[model samples]
Target: MDPAKLSNAIENVHRAGMPGLFAEVRDGDEVWRGAAGVADLSTGRPVTADMRHRVGSITKTFTAAAVLHLVDGGEIGLDAPVGRYLPELVPGERGDAITVRMLINHTSGLGEYLPYAYPSLRAFPDLAECRPQSLDDHRLTRFDSTELIEMGVTAPAAGAPGGTPGLYSNTNYLLLGQLLERVTGVAAEKYITQNVIERAGLQDTEFPDGPQINGPHSRAYEAFFGMIDPPRDYSVFDMSYAGPSASLISTVADLNRFFGLLLAGEIVHPSSLARMQRTVPIVSQEGKVIEYGLGLYPMEAAGGGIFWGHGGTTWGAGALSMIRGDGGRRMSVAMNLQRWNTLDASGRPQPHPIDDALAALYRVAMSG
Candidate 1:
């Protein structure tokens, strides 16, 4: 790898307005790690390669791996209706029609709970007197999965169960988390930690049970909808609201290790891993074309080829982990800022700084 090119990529991320960013790349026996910007803007603490960050939806990959592990063990059937495991949680009719496969592949058509749970203060009659911010006051409150599911269950369904195109809803994985517990008699966190984290030997990865990140971590900051005067310190918010959907915290090294091992067929059985790579085209709400597999995503590599992994976004953090399919090359990127959208007046997303940063990083990481 060219050091100059790699350094330029890291600098590009900083220039994109990310307070801090870190990344790890692995090709065969060679490993490259880099960090730029401040981990804590207040203290001017620079980000380091080993610093942990909230890897939002990337947690879905772990959750999906756990679910697939159950499938491999015959404890759970992929084609079986999720209602078979948690009948009381899902809507009576819709639950019966949705299969575990649909949930993992994001074809369940379930609504997201966050919007309902934290609607704009102006929209909620009872909270009209409260601040306009959605999650400001509830940041520290521990939420129950059941209540969160109920919020989705009551919201308008995105489409008929398994009949619509891929709709990325955290509700799908939230229910899967409940299903994992129902099947294995273990919490989703424990199952994933044992099956995925431990299996991959990710020493710095964990499913934190509280608001605080236990080890060395970047202070997460969020400009909620870009409305907050200054980005709020959301590094300490209770992750229960995100639960099995987006609660995993990890470092770039650990993330790279996990994805590397996962694609190498060490995390799940070959057959199960193959199934996880089967994907469906998904156009994100922002109109980006994504191909989502069971818990993984196929990103078009800069040098031509597919890199499989997932990207995650929490309120104050963002993460990306991808491994080339043809070779074992892997890269993981993390940022300490969230809601960093640059939208036009029509609310359409324009390319943000992270896009340029990621493109630069990918060019270097995937280069031979």
Candidate 2:
């Protein structure tokens, strides 16, 4: 397909009264990148390939790589109890039940909402106000892993150990982040920057400190309580609370390179990379049978190719990333608006418009 026509197809999505977006497709040595919508709609800034956006759970892929690096170094074992690294994590039911692999695979039977439950804690005027959380009340906002684990102990387990698979949970990755820090004797960000991001030659990506999107970024919009126009207040979507579960931010180009290098065995030892992609059964969100590998989600696309990547949703962001296993191609999309629960008048989540746009991009990438 001609790049111009492909670009027109992506831009026409917003023209169809859906939403404007920026996208990029890379093939072998050829790269076609373009942004066709208002990035910062508030100020009319146009989207660009370099514009940074929240990667949400896509950060897990990096964290998993770091853990596997330590494993390659013989510093940690996959089936070893997390208690071996962080003794504090061994409390109540989580004491002997959770292992390093279980945490990464979300088989640890931990609760899922300890991270997102903050938004439902107080009656908010809107999702935006709940996200950015005003400075005056900042002192009251803190999400500690210790407390999160304790909360999980009380909630009903998704299933018994090795019983059944569960969806993605921030608690799983948060524990993995702590375990990585413990074994490597380095901060998660530093280790990731040195081993993963820096090694990938991604000059445009950085781990952000909080919820706000800095530098050249997409126009972040919010769909709160199902209102389509915009969000009322976005004060509580603090990224700090997210920690390693979903704190990293990057551009589409950086994400593409990171995924490519990761799957190619450039980031970790060969055996470790093999272990990282090794998968087990996990429940599918769309009722499409799928498998959850170490940090990646392996799902069959409509085109009949198995793609490996992750989708992320934060306060006002919805993101999708995927790469074909054979190194044929890869695609990633990020939108500034998100609504996890609230639905449109026709009764659907607001982020679906952007999600569909991302799927379209994946289809084009696979067409090659």
- Which candidate ranks first by lDDT, i.e. highest? 1
Off by over 4 Å in 1: 121-132, 285-289
lDDT tens digits, residue span 180-205, model 2: 77777887788888888898899877
lDDT of 1 by residue, 1-368 (tens): 77678888888879888888888888888888899999888899898998888999999999999999889999999999888888899758877899999999888878777777776643322322324366677888888999999987787877777764677888889999999889878898998888888888889889887999998889888864456557877888889988889999999888888887787778889899999989886545444557788989888876688889888888788898888995488888998887666446654446776777768777788764
Candidate 1, residue 247: lDDT: 95
Off by more than 4 A, model 2: 16-19, 115-142, 225-229, 232-237, 284-289, 340-357
Structural similarity to truth (TM-score) of each candidate: 0.94, 0.85
> Candidate 2 — worst ten consecutive residues by lDDT sum?
120-129
Cα lDDT, model 2, residue 156: 61
The residue pairs in collision within model 1 are none
Instruction: Give each model's whole-structure lDDT.
Output: 0.82, 0.68
